[model samples]
Target: MRSILAVFKREVALYFRSPIAYAIPFALTLFFGLLFNDTVTRNNQNAPADVIMTFIPGLFTFLLFLIAPLLTMRLLAEETREGTLEILMTLPMKEWHFIVGKFLAAWLYYTVLLALTLVYAGILWRIGVPDAGIAFGAYFGAWLYGGAVLAMTLIWSAVTEDQIVAAFLGAATILVLWLADIAAAWFANLSNTGEQNSVVAEVIRELGLRAHYTFTMAQGIIRAEDILYFIFMMIAGLFITTRIVEVRRWRS
Candidate 1:
């Protein structure tokens, strides 16, 4: 526990000390600010809920791909590249401890970034009534979504010593997940909606990152399946990361 905290503290410091760490959130703020302004400004007739509900979920999904790779690209890759991973492995600590600590640190940083987005919701509330449930749901969904993304990227980082390679792979993997719905769409278009096609389509849509949040969570409904998907993906990623790190230690 103490070692985990130590690593967590070190990682938090490393993130804040670096100027580049702030760049993605800064960009996110700018993009979301613009999006919110445009949404509210253009929305004269509808309730503020309409604008917010429409914007937040899609934006969160879009931002996930961009932010996850940037934050996690260097987590383990940098350590390996600089040969510090070997030094760290020699310490009297378990691999999961180090992995969990670093994952928590990155997760906390993403939470901070997501927190900044609440200002947009606050602004909407002041202007007009927004659905509190939907707003809060969107935020909760984003937090979990970010965790899943970070976990996957950390896996990529664990296997690769080059930060650029790790970042590219992470981003690519995220892009594929983000577009998973498209694959479903294509298959549906090619095949008639029969029992077989329906089953295939259902499976494909369920595998995509967008449908779970867009259909349910974004609409203010929290389904257990959606929540579990994120949790399962996150744990799966972390588990894979731990194994990879363990293998590397053995080889060293």
Candidate 2:
């Protein structure tokens, strides 16, 4: 427990101290602003707070693919590159401790980034206060969504020693997931009433990150299943990360 806290503290501090955190968040905010502004300005020209809130969470989904890799690309790869991982392995702490702690730190960093986006709420407030229930749901959904993305990228970090390789793998994997969502949408829209095709609909729905993000969050309906799905994904990814680190240690 003590060792985990030590690692967590160190990693949390490193993220704040390093320029990587700022660089990624700034890029994300820039992209998000462009998208949200375009939607609000064009579709609902001179819209109210509730309408903008509806648009922001959906637009926020795009950043998951672009910025999530930044959180995990350095986790184990940097240690391996610097030869620090070997020394850490020789210490009293086990692999899972390091893995979970680092994962938590990264998770917290991403979660904070999501929270900072509440400034969007403030912006909305300047126009008019939106529905509190819907805004809360949207924020909650975005938080879990970010958690799942960070966990996915952490898996890439555990296996690869090169940061570039890790980042590429992370981004490519995310891109595939995004593409799967699009394919599912196409399939889902094929049938009349979007039903009568159970197999196709089920497969497509399962692959949809945006389905959960848009309906559950932006629509202000919190679903237990979606939240649990993200929790399961995050835990599964980190567990695999621990296993990979353990195997790497055993090999040496």
Reference-based lDDT, each prediction: 0.85, 0.80
Error of 1 at 207 (Å): 1.4
Error at 223, model 2, angstroms: 0.7
Q: What are the runs in model 1 whose C-alpha is more than 4 Å off? A: 192-194
Residue 62 lDDT, candidate 2, scale 0-100: 68
Looking at candidate 2, the ten consecutive residues that score lowest on lDDT are 190-199
The numbered model that scores best in TM-score is 1
Best by lDDT: 1
Model 1 lDDT at residue 91: 90
- Per-residue lDDT of candidate 2, residues 91-196 (tens digit): 9998889998998898898777776667777777776668988888887888888788788888888888888889999988777765666776666677474455
Clashing pairs in 1: none
